[model samples]
Target: MAVHSSDYPFSAFPSPLTTSPKVPNPESQTPSPAAAAAAAHGGSAKKRKSGLIECQEPQGGGNSAGESSLDLISWLPDEVLGTVISLLPTKDGARTQAVSRRWRPLWRAAPLNLGASSDLTDQDQKRLVFVSKILSDHPGPARRFSLPCMRLRDRYAKINGWLRSQTLTGLEEIQFGYEIEDPLLHYPLPPSALRFAPTLRIAYFGYCDFPREMAPLLKFPCLKQLNLCGVIVLEDVLHSLLCGCPVLESLLLEGNVGVGCLRINSPTLRSIGISVSCYGTRVENPILLQDLIIEDAPCLERLLPLYPIRGPLTIRVVRAPKLEISGWLSDSITKLHIGTTVFQKMIALSLTTSMRSTVKVLALDTFGPNLDSVVDFLKCFPCLQKLYIKADLQKSRKNKWSYNPLDPIECLESHLRQVVVMKYWGMRPDVDFAKFFVLNAKVLKKMVFGCINNCNDNWMANQHRRLQLDNKASQGVEFKFRRGSCSISLTHSRHKQDDPFDSHIFADDA
Candidate 1:
């Protein structure tokens, strides 16, 4: 759903403008009150004036409705308009002063949103100099400060100076040290950033050169969410960082983890997302984690490896019985050690692994949509209820759903209720995979298909007939088909503000 603005998009007054004012909605009918008055009262000006005397006269123009042609925005109070301007980029926000006299003081008075590149026109200008000027001009109390590190190759001290500036005195959220556009942009953690340790609630930084032997007392008491992407910190320093955040709830570790194996033992932590390399991309001097052992996370609920874009990772759960949802499980995973069972390459190899009755929601990022491997997972997770699968056909063509009708998987027969299949191209392989649930999932309540490759009217008809929806085992199951994809990927960041497992947030990222 998109927000709508009541004011017209065009300027209030225009030269050679016609009497027919522009109406934003083509379906809406806006009658000019003045024109109607002329027709109804036989051009009686006195009667129209008497009827609408209390209404303010439109100063300049309006739509063809014979109402005020005013911009309507100028009528908003200073605080409301200032807040809107404050949310804009620094360059655009400052330019709002040119709108009118009422807007001149709003930008400077409102909270500062300083992005160094904004408002700078000269390509040759030094990054530090331009950022410094903005800080010097704006008053204290910054909301968000972003410094993009391009090929300028600036020193870390530049960022240190910005963090120390008075403009960001009480600022809490900071994203610095690295730039995604320049993957090679690595910098050492500046000492100035520790100033916000007591106040920061959310923080993100990458490509940092962590100093050895972090002080025993370093901490972030207010931080609830943290991301150290590509920040290669040693095992001891990583331990100190986690210990300091006594209330930290979410953590994201991307590539360059700088540790071979990680042991987590947090009381308040609830969510953890790791992104590692799945396709063996050659990352320069990458130090990715191979093993993640949750020794004791009592409050943990979600353990997600959003994507395999970073490097290989193997997860072993030691004591997170509260862990309810986990995945984006793909080929990048070397092992998933839960209880006594060991799952490698999307299939359980060890029969000794105990059943995971606590795991209710499972997400799979599979290349083949291989139901045979999924059946093995069902045997391990008998109580699983919600399944989110993003299946592709480019690879893993060898595995097939070779289950016999006489035998049954525990999840398919009773527990599995809601199944969401993403990026489904209704080919023979996909049709067979989906039809399996329609015929076998006796307790199924809803099945959502996001089809793209073959989604025309005729294709949908063919899929409907092939799926045999009429004979679905679940009597009242809701079968929905739409032309799109869903997100099975999860990344812990402010960029994705909502819960990663939310169905409302899904779209093609899978």
Candidate 2:
């Protein structure tokens, strides 16, 4: 249950072990600045713990400014320089004030960011004392604040004081979680938590319980993204929270959510990611997210199941007119309902969705080589253009993948343009599975096989013979092969990668 750098949504900030963000040398970044900062890193015990203060001036003294001699960074426009300092770590950002008279006012004028980690010190008392000092020093209009993981039951008063700081009036993002030791972890959701809700754009809460009674009192007009990673809230409270965030675009309900079902009815919601992750635990019977019904989400584009859940989770899509998913769909879903069509147990019982053109890009995580399901899905999504399949390397059914030439798939014949398969171990079933596409897909332009094992000249020739590439259906098809496998890493990072579900995370060695 311990928190690591990865646990934090924005891994760049608030890490006790992290160094100050690398500041550039005016024109372009060289390796020199980072090395210099590393060599000269020194500050208060708190700042030293966070590995900050490259500007490393004494706490509040500017008379000894070595920076006064070579002042290239200070030449930047006040607006530009202030922004640069604002993005630095709290200790580093605060340290810049001591560099020179030019830098002193800049730190106070720039929007503030305050971050504390549980590991910042051996005791929360010492960390709170340092945080209290920063609160009293900074003036106003804070940008983001991340409250370190702590037991809310004991430190709620301290958190209240921090939230009540005059500096955080225009706060944009805030994150907090309750320590498992809190006996009253769920009840009386901190009243000061929503002090700047109107201005908040992103909120991440963990291990807390939402009170349905207080839902009517909430309104987050500017909230765009809300992530309640590990929490327990009643079904109505969940819907009520969505109602309050009238403009929320991205919603993630991850980590063994204790809700009977999640029914979304939002006009502005764009994407939803759900996962039941019990990576390390000994809960006798943990609650899991059950049914996900899109009662009405006209603007919704993507429905992502980020982590593979062990239990059944039915997804009934009543209305998601613009949904375009890539690689987040597979057998993990107990049942899938796209419009009027029903896809259960990898069989298409009906093909009645009028929004057949909605799914242009799809990525499927087949537990194993389940070709029939892929074919069935093609029937459901006939207008798909890009298809990415990550299948298990285990031996599939002995029967060959059979699809009638007389009965054509719409996407394979006319629409489907690219096909990429990851973890392609060239066993007997793997050959049968891939050769079918090579022999049939008439409009397929590219076929990429990400093989698990490395191949030599002789091995490549043997596999080429098995797939019968010489007699392929598409004359202009470009086939490629590469070693290693890939799967999407669902870890959230607001700064580096905006979309958690994108294929940007996949690489040769991943």
Candidate 3:
């Protein structure tokens, strides 16, 4: 589960440490007869040296018994020792109490991580009672107290009273699961209970509701990580709670009830990850994050928009210097979806010579119409390298493939090296276009065409054949036309889904 240090007991040592120690060097040239005799009586020699010896004494601090004891528990850190004990079956952990006095205290006080099947059975209840009695008699804060699948409602009052009185002063973790029919009665935590906890770091609230003042009840100032999944909170309540958690750096929200623009601003905050269903009516102002996450943060790198774009979305990026789109560009971006329409707009802009070269990557679902016109528009991008496109081979109502290969992108041979074609249903028109790209692209390294379905065996076969022919050619250019599975399939066995906006919809302007 948790990776521990490999050095083990050797980690406790200074200077000399190894999994296997080297044998001591041979004695001086003139070996003492006493040293030879000492080697012979191996079993009896070690017992002669015992108790605290001075620092300079040769055999003083090194004892076989102490070394053996330390070696057994070498890898066990104080942090994970509780985990190892919790993972043990109840009987096994309890049996360890007699081994040593040091174990007896931790076995009782450490937060127990009982397995899923560790609920109290009839005999187990008796044993647990005896164990609990023994632990209660010897008192201190338990580092951990874990019980899972426990039907402890009948003893809730008693357990709660004991927990309150005990006041786990040093408890770092407390994992307890209860399966009760009705919701447990709300119990207010005493001031002493909250104040006593100095090292309490993490807590999981599953199927549990926090009081209105859960922020104060929890010493929010000390927490660095907070995970809220499947928890109920009023609108803006979570945001308020997080604002109070000054030291909180990481926040994960999954399947939360109240969903809206999550406003978060904390200097200590470095990473944030959120996924929510955005199929419903769009919120007016979903999120307004500032200072904490700006344009230039190599640390805060991921922007996961889990929800679908519900309405006309416009991201007014003031100055996101390092922002780059990696996966699945939004379909609702009007300019990206309106392939030919965007070309027409660009054509118009090119006429006035006013179009800026700010846009870098231009990915088209269909590169059918106005190729010449769009190329005229993209002439502004002097540093363009990648051109991603998906073309519809079927003849549209207006005309066949009207885009000529020689006019626009022909000049971009030096700038564009890779052209990715999505939804490549093996059609003659698409193949013919692929042939044109293979012939014209001077700096092209790869032309990736993807098949739509697994059952499209014929398409895959033809693609393979085309790839082979290109690979073994003599006069043709040295560009690769790699074919594989389809990136996205549109063969729904029904009518093709048409977007409300035609091609050439400017996404950034949305």
Q: Model 1, residue 278: what's the lDDT?
A: 19
Which prediction has the highest lDDT against the true structure?
Answer: 2
Q: Give the count of colliding residue pairs in each prediction.
A: 8, 1, 16
Query: What TM-score does prediction 1 earn?
Result: 0.71
Those runs of model 2 whose alpha carbons end farther than 4 Å from true positions after fitting are 1-77, 118-126, 151-153, 179-189, 277-286, 310-312, 393-406, 494-510
TM-scores, all models, native as reference: 0.71, 0.79, 0.44
Clashes by residue pair, model 2: 327-363
For model 1, residues 11-116, the per-residue Cα lDDT tens digits are 1322322232222222213222222223334433443344345665432333333333323343344555555655665555555554444445666787777766
Q: Candidates 1 and 2: which is better by TM-score?
A: 2
The per-residue C-alpha lDDT of model 3 at residue 92 equals 42
In candidate 1, position 70 carries an lDDT of 29
lDDT of 1 at 303: 81
- Estimate, for each residue in 1-510, the C-alpha lDDT of model 2 and write its tens digit: 344433322223321211223332222232222233333332323343332245543333333344422343443446655666566666556556544555567777888877666433446666667677667877867888887466565666777788888889989998877667634334334767777889999998777666667777788999999988666666777777788998999887777445767788999988777776552342435566778889999898777776554423688889888876633676777787878888775567787764667878777777556777788788788888888788775664552666677987888889888887878888887777788889989988988787777867777999899999999989999888877665554554521233343453234332
Candidate 1 C-alpha error for residue 279, in Å: 14
CA lDDT, every model vs. true structure:
0.66, 0.68, 0.39
